[model samples]
Target: MTFSPDLTETLLRPLLRTDPHRPRLTWYGGEPAGRTELSTASLANWAAKTAGLLTDELGVAPGAGVRVLGLRSWQVLPAALGSWWAGLALDLSAAGAGFADAVFAAPDADPEVVAALVDESDPDTVLALSTHPLALPAGDLPPGARDYSIAVRAHADRFPGVPVEPTATVLQADGPLGGDAATVADVIERARALAAGWGAQPRVLAELGVTVRTTAELVAAAVAALAVDGSLVVVDPASGHAAGTVGADEQITVSHPF
Candidate 1:
């Protein structure tokens, strides 16, 4: 149940291959009422295409820094993979907390950037990343980024994995911590044990940022769920923090919440 740095590829990949979509991704977003879904297969293709544009066209190095600009979602997964597939580091910057790259903004984004994969949202919320530019809903877009389709479609449909260097950084959330500190590897390992007790290879995973939750709780739980070929069901913000847990069988652990 212990997770290593290489677990994402070594042990986790095979576990994640629940369907033929292991190499692909899926995303579900919304609150209160559920929204729609995005398939991994679709994401895989998009990631490949994006990787191509970012590397071949834009000339971003395999180990260069590439930042993701949003919270968890189907699109964000592909964007992350596309960066990894292109051999770039993922700088995960919280939307409000500014990073140098995040400060670059959509308007200032250029070929140096691989691409900004914004959520396909209402004309206002993420209209910048949507295919449409005309009619608008009710919201404001953090200017500069383009529609995800424009970025995704600009490249080829296939990309290879990019290697990483020790000094390179890919921001990720760790488990709980003291004050501003985050959890260590040992704690994440213990949580894996707790998950195994409830059920190994969990199917559904739910993570909320409302409080002091650990990233290990989030990623490890998702990885474990995927390990058992289970669907990693993301809990929406509006959905509150409720999830269902079923007896272990085909589904394994029904739900994991952080």
Candidate 2:
């Protein structure tokens, strides 16, 4: 599955145009046998809304840096994709919050902890996600901080901004050797390579805390799955379900740690 240099053109737009109803991501975790699924259309919609929130409401401009915490949930997918859609540089490194223009964290994360990490940054720049299975809002956020699940809902379902530059830096991270920045072209190419290795339309199962660590890796994995018109089944290590059992149940064709 070869891809264009543009991330949106390669990974996102294609899915929306063809087979938009097909399930792209399926998550299994949370209390009381929780299961949630997002089709290609649904994922794209959320990404667009998130982009709208960043650009329209938060006043974050293109090429700005956005740091994301808590990578072990389905909500991270739309947020990561939306950042790219808005042409923001995503930093997934452990020490990214210091240099970020905005920070997104999980709902359960302590506000004080995130506040301490963001330091002098504006409290409004911090957005916390509920990670609700039904996409509910996270209520009772700290004063000045934004609720992602609530605020994002007010945005349009389609991004009304300019297309992202293919050469723009999309991700900043620590590569296998050292720190590196990946452009949209680089990410697309990496996704293509991953899809090639996974074979045609492979159903991949990955454990969030174990197999995946950073949101960048998860985004790459998602693009790989989408490139081949496949799907991703994500599970938390704490789900207490054996990988083999879940793989067999989900009919997963591949299982790899990201």
Candidate 3:
């Protein structure tokens, strides 16, 4: 497969190679999940390892389905980028989980739901993410399921993906609130437009909520910040820090506070 420049190429790859140390994301709160920042290089490394785990270990390929469960957090960004790197499409709903080649659930995911899903998903791979900055292993994985921290850590720091078609479906979210699937090319286009519209802002802070994933603007916003040589700050509710606090401390210019 030949390498193609889609969303990851437009946002991640070049950023990693050219401006690797530039801060991309900053998360502030407390304890195990508090005050975290990722540079382009740091985020790329995580995405590459995740891509390796999915493509090499799980046999995920172009057009493969991967469902991500639970709330938005730091982990979702890299994991989503990795899936796109591997040319796999992302699904964010339970109804789509059965057909997904792989499923990644956050540690705070409903235990019963995860258990049932894992039990029903035999040969299919299920990864439970701990979201700890230390990549700590989660306790009590369901049968046939694996810990994302352990699995991803085993992969190399740099896992470049195969060539992918720009038109290939990269994400889908058709729920009651209404959503549409976007191709790699489509997502890139939107990212560019958002970047241009946001002017030359150097930083953006946004609420990390359901809309971030469903609207496909999470990728757009992050890439937009990068387009202007800026950083994206995510306000995670679980962090216990108020939006006002993050905005004040981070000097956030654009945001929808919770």
Model 3: per-residue lDDT, tens digit, 1-111? 444664565667666667788778886632365677888988888888888898898887778888777644567677777887777888754456355788787665666
Q: List, residue by residue over 50-136, the lDDT tens digit for candidate 2.
A: 888888888899889988776655778888888878878888776664647777787545567676755667777888776557767
Q: Model 1, 12: alpha-carbon shift in Å?
A: 8.0
Could you estimate the TM-score for every candidate? 0.56, 0.87, 0.83
> Judged by TM-score relative to the true structure, which candidate is superior, 1 or 3?
3
Best by lDDT: 2
Instruction: Report clash pairs, candidate 2.
Output: none
For model 1, residues 1-258, the per-residue Cα lDDT tens digits are 332232223223344344444322223333223333334454456567767766776666655555544343334445545655665544443332222221112221232332333322222212123211221221333543445545456577655455444344433433421122222233234435544544543455454443213323444444444434444555445343343321122232454443
lDDT of each: 0.41, 0.73, 0.68
Model 3 C-alpha RMSD vs. true structure (Å) is: 3.5
lDDT, candidate 2, residue 11? Answer: 77
Give the total clashing residue pairs for model 3: 1
Name the regions of candidate 3 deviating beyond 4 angstroms: 1-3, 29-33, 93-98, 110-113, 140-144, 174-178, 209-220
Model 1 residue runs over 4 Å out of place are: 1-18, 21-35, 38-40, 93-140, 165-200, 207-224, 227-229, 237-254
RMSD of 1: 8.6
- By TM-score, rank the candidates, best first: 2, 3, 1
